[model samples]
Target: MPILKDFRYHAPVGVDEALALLHKSKKPLLLGGGTFVLNTLKKTAAYPTDVIGLRKIASLHGIRDAAKEVTIGSMTTLAEVASSPVVGEHFASLAGAAACVATTPLRHMATIGGNVASRFFWVDLPSVLMALGAKVAWAGDKAKKTLSVEDFLSLTGPEARGIVTEVLLPKSGLTGVYFRHTQTMEVDLPLVAMAFAARRQAGGVKDVRCIVNTTLSRPVRLTGVASYFETKKVTEWKADEAADVLRRDLEQGKLDDYRLHCLCADLESLIDKFKKA
Candidate 1:
């Protein structure tokens, strides 16, 4: 049985209060939906002295749709993101990733903010968010920063620690699609995944973004694959040809044969979907 050690728990109703509590504690852990943090606490040997619960903060809740963009609060759960009409309409890939996270009860308790902040490479949303060109609105003791999701994901060590206040996704009119391959249907966690987004022009596409989550490293941008597909008419896309480009894009990556095969299969599916679109 896992045992939680004695710790101070602080539920702050405001961001300012939460920050104060965070900076004051000797070892502080931020609690969002409590899906990740609570579970980590049960097994972590390096226990935090204080757990700052952000659930009560009024500012960190809800999904808001505006003329220019959609804002999802940090505390918003995966279940909420998956079910949101605005998210479903504007960012289908994000909604799909959220829906694919875990079992029903886990989705209800796991948050988008926690998922992103956890920085676990196997987690579903980051690659999709990267493909959608989302920005993370973050607050820390030093500054309030809004970083591109790609930039945020590249942060390492202490640079990654902060309060993710919200995710800002612009209404770019880009269609996004996500494909994740799990080791088994029983496990919702992704073993490898791909997120593709592009703006469909009259006969071609523009601003194409292809991001792949190897679950072995940071989500890799398939630049060659994106470049190959860019400005080409949908009719010109050949799955086999695109697979060759994908192979070149991942040549530098240390992927095993099975995962590589899976990515190639995903590429074919993506091309076929777009061709039929």
Candidate 2:
């Protein structure tokens, strides 16, 4: 571990108080569960003069299940997410993704907000969130707004001057499945991943969303692969044909053969799941 430089840390009890502190502090960094920021602070020279910790904020910590969607507070930890029966019942892909993060203790310390806000391309949540068609409720200097996970990730430095308040997951009667691959143990950083989701329509499935996290850049949506699966019945889906289209979908991604092989194998497993479903 690198040496963590000296910095003044403030714990605010509410979002408004935290935002006020943010407005006044120069080069301030917001701390969520501290799994990412604390690690980052040890290595980065662009240190914050003030570290505003959001842990004390009560409003930022619960899972609310509504009739239309599930609202997860930004400060909700991965362990909380993984254990929430509502999350597991409604958003199985996200629940599975959360459960697969780091280890038990680390999961307890890592917030969903930190996971999404870090935008560390290689991390696990973004692709699964995108596959689930999730959105973030953001509070910023200018105004409050809701943006899709894809749009939220696309924001640049200046444009990202805000905090994510909540992650909104709509209930769409969709079945979601996630598959992750790592070079070594299951706890290792994933080399690649795939998130598959779709709604069962009459005689077939529709709204197919196939997402691949390359762990290189932004996660790619496998539109070609999704299109191929969209029109076909679950029984008609074949692994070899799906693999061929997946290769075309990933033509520009320039992934190494190993990553591609893992993804193909996962795709075959996904097809098997569909058949079983």
Candidate 3:
């Protein structure tokens, strides 16, 4: 492992101060829980000259539960998110994702900001958040902005420089399930992951959002499958039909036969579980 080079650390007390530091530094990296940042620095030759820690910022710490929405501070630890009653009650899929991340010690140190910002396909939170229709709030040197999770994941270059302040999730009538499949019992990284969210209507499913990750470069919604489900009765959902829709929608060249099999099985299992609920 490469040793992290000497770097100046700045623990800013406010968002403005943090942005100022980030803009002024030759190579500045925002520090969330330091789980991803520190680990990356130790493994790669690329290292930032300055680290702007967000720990001192008071606004980026707790969860806010409103009548129609829930806002999670970017600096909030995964462990806190997993254990929060508000999150468990409103977004159980998110809670389950948080609880299954790495292990207990890493969860205590990993923040949602870093996890989403890292944009690693294997990371659990991004898929669940995207499926839940979450939005990201960012703070930068010039101004603050809010973007949907899908848009945020596509950012690059200057567009990705801002510091994430919070994650906003609208409270909805939809129910969701998040499933993670690892290669083995000891492996933390998932081989395949799926998130399913939908509102059970009188005659069928509504507002269906089915996301698949780990087997792709980024999480992608199975729009074809979702549309198929939206038109069919919940009791009539079939595993083979769901599998055929997804196979037709996705690029077969990107996934081999085994992965395709796993994806189909997981999606079928998720749909069965969702219907039973």
Q: Write the per-residue lDDT of candidate 2 for residues 137-205, one digit (tens) a residue.
A: 988787889999999999886678778899999999789999998889845788899998999886578
Clashes of each: 0, 0, 0
Point out the worst 10-residue segment of candidate 3 by lDDT: 251-260
- The alpha-carbon lDDT assigned to residue 30 of candidate 2 equals 93
Could you give candidate 1's per-residue lDDT for residues 1-277 as a string of tens digits? 9777899999999887888888889999999988878777888977999999998998899999999999999999999999999999999999999998988999998899999998888888989999999999988667889999878888776676678999999999999999889998887679999999999988788899999999988899999999888857889988888889988999999788889888889888888888887
Indicate the worst ten consecutive residues by lDDT in candidate 2.
182-191
Winning model by lDDT:
2
Q: List the residue pairs that clash in candidate 2.
A: none
Model 3, 75-142: lDDT tens per residue?
Answer: 99999999999999999999999999899999999999988988887788888898899999987556
Residue 182, candidate 1: Cα error in Å is 0.3
Task: Score candidate 1 by lDDT.
Answer: 0.90
Q: Candidate 1 or 3, higher TM-score?
A: 1
Assess the local accuracy of residue 216 in candidate 1 as a C-alpha lDDT between 0 and 100.
87
